[model samples]
Target: MSFVTDHILKNPPVLLGLIAMIGLIVQRKTFAEVVKGSLTAVFGMVALTAGVNMLTGTIAPINTAVQTQLGVQVADGLSDVTFTAEYGGTVGLAMFLD
Candidate 1:
């Protein structure tokens, strides 16, 4: 139960997929349609995640270089923060609620 709650239920991609599936089901869609919709939602979430990671990866180096040139220092304990690591759950919950 914990595993299901922590992994499958809490996961944003799966939660989005489930929402898609449920919505389709409520609309009286066929099984195939529901499956396709759910898969599309999940895949879309995966793609969005990948794009964010790529953008962050591209920006981090430039940000570091600018900070170095300007003699700016990152605040304490914030040097390693990443978007997904910081707000992934909140993003997922917001998506689910919407």
Candidate 2:
């Protein structure tokens, strides 16, 4: 049953539809009502996934353009060590008090 479980976990929309259908059936919903409710849930999830994909796709080009234009240089690990050396004692005391 590992194969079955793997497929079930991978497709969350299907799992959610199955759960909604089962809940509706247990509540003695009509056949039509069960089908409608389950399909609505599944389609809603699909639409949400599509919308998020489109949003991310649209933002990626903008992000790339901004990063390229900015020509920003980030300092390496030197700053992190310097910060700790300067403030480590104060931070350690604050944490001890907390």
Candidate 3:
């Protein structure tokens, strides 16, 4: 249905878990093994997402402090600046190249 496609399919963790389950099934794994593999994949993705979010959160304050110490100025008409807002394009390009 639309809900399944929109929610479960679009979600990376769940899609990965489904792939794991399908692979286990193809290998003739037991039910418990299939369930365990799928859950493990899902949990791993969740953990990775959590870790990235945590790292970004930790970096925000450090970025703010460095900007403050360096006396960085905000551009005109901008009320607030953020680490991502300032460096996201460069970071994205670096990531794309890598």
Scored by lDDT, the top model is 1
RMSD of 3: 8.6
Better candidate by lDDT, 1 or 2: 1
Clashing pairs in 1: none
Model 1 C-alpha lDDT per residue in residues 1-98, reported as the tens digit of each score: 44545566557789889889989999999999999999999999999988988999999899999999999987755532455455655665566567
TM-score of every prediction relative to native: 0.71, 0.61, 0.61
Cα error, residue 45 of model 2, in Å, equals: 0.7
TM-score of 3: 0.61
lDDT of 2 by residue, 1-98 (tens): 44434454345566668767878998999999999999998898789878887997899688778868997644556553466555544554443345
lDDT of 3 by residue, 1-98 (tens): 54555456556678779778988998999999999999999999999988988887999798789889999964664521354445444544443345
Q: Using lDDT as the measure, what is the rank order of every candidate, best first?
A: 1, 3, 2
RMSD of each: 3.6, 14.7, 8.6
Off by over 4 Å in 3: 63-98
